[model samples]
Target: MEFSVMLELLFSGLLFTLEIFVVTLVGALPLGVPVALARMSKHKWLAWIARIYISVMRGTPLMLQLMAIMFGPYYLFHLNMGPDWKYWACGIGFIINYAAYFAEIYRSGLQSIARGQHEAAEVLGYTRAQAFTRIVLPQVVKRVLPAIGNEVITLVKDTSLAFVLGIMEMFSQAKALAASQVSMVPYAIAALIYWVFNFIVEMALTRVEKQLAYYHD
Candidate 1:
């Protein structure tokens, strides 16, 4: 294939890879906050349930989760594994898996805040909800920014795992093209693409961190 044609195919596949990263972040980050809160809840059962979930998600390999999500429905319920199920399963698996990681990050951030902060909020007549949403959450976000950035970068590379389910992400596409053309050029291009994507994520997160720098503790 011509270089331009090869580039086009790689770019097309890159879009799907980017979709997985973007959707996973968008879905995981918000959902993770509540999961984190539940993990720290006063109620024993709620905290226990959240802890077990986080443990399971963190303990197992993400590829295993993806495979289970992709195949479990058909195996357990005898549902059809249609053509589009791969993307759906991949999206759901990525979101939940990353959410567990994010939840732990969030829990650490939340716990790092001094107990006095919550007491101060209460003394000022703020409800628990108001205290968390207005005061605690902002600081937690600032503190967790670096950790979140690291996970986000990892997610960029992890998008390649979608290939196990037959999804044509960039790495998979590159492998296919390289095999067909008997050239290493496709893999090289894919590497460059992944590097550029991760570079952008790091730069963006650094900018956000700087913006929050003025926020002390």
Candidate 2:
């Protein structure tokens, strides 16, 4: 392939990779909060359900989860596995897996807040919702920003795993190009692309962390 053609193919793959990363983050981050809350709920059944979900998701390999999501519906429920199910399965798998990880990070941040803050909020006539949303969640975000940044960076790289389900992400495109050309240059370019992506993520998250630093003393 010509150099320009190779670059175009890689760029196309990168777009798909970014699509997966963005969708996963959008779906997982907010979904994680509720899962975290359920895990910490006073209700034993809710907490137990959340615990089991987190454990199963965390314990299994994401690649396996992706495969399961792609195939499980057909095998378990006798449903059709259509052509477009690849991206849907990939997106759902990434969302659920990352949500489990984020849930734990959220739980840790929530637990780190001093009980006195909750008490103070209540004493000031704040309802539980107001106290949590207004007083508690902001601090949790500040404390958990670094942890979330780490996960966000990981998700960028994990986008390559979409190839396991035959989605042609950047890394997969590079691999195919390298195989066809019998050169490692494509792989090297892919590595550079991944590094640049993570670098951008780190820089953006650093700015977010700084913005939240006002919450500190």
- Give me the candidate number with maximum lDDT: 1
RMSD of 1: 1.3
Candidate 2: worst-modelled 10 consecutive residues by lDDT: 208-217
**Residue pair clashes in candidate 1:** none
User: Which tens-of-lDDT digit does each residue in 106-212 have in candidate 2?
Assistant: 99999999999999999999999999998898899999999999999999989989999999999999999999999998898889999999999999999988888
How do all models score by TM-score?
Answer: 0.95, 0.96
Residue 9: error of model 2 in Å? 0.5
Model 1 regions more than 4 Å off: none
Candidate 1 lDDT over 119-140, as tens digits, reads: 9999999999999999987898
How displaced is residue 27 in candidate 2, in Å?
0.5
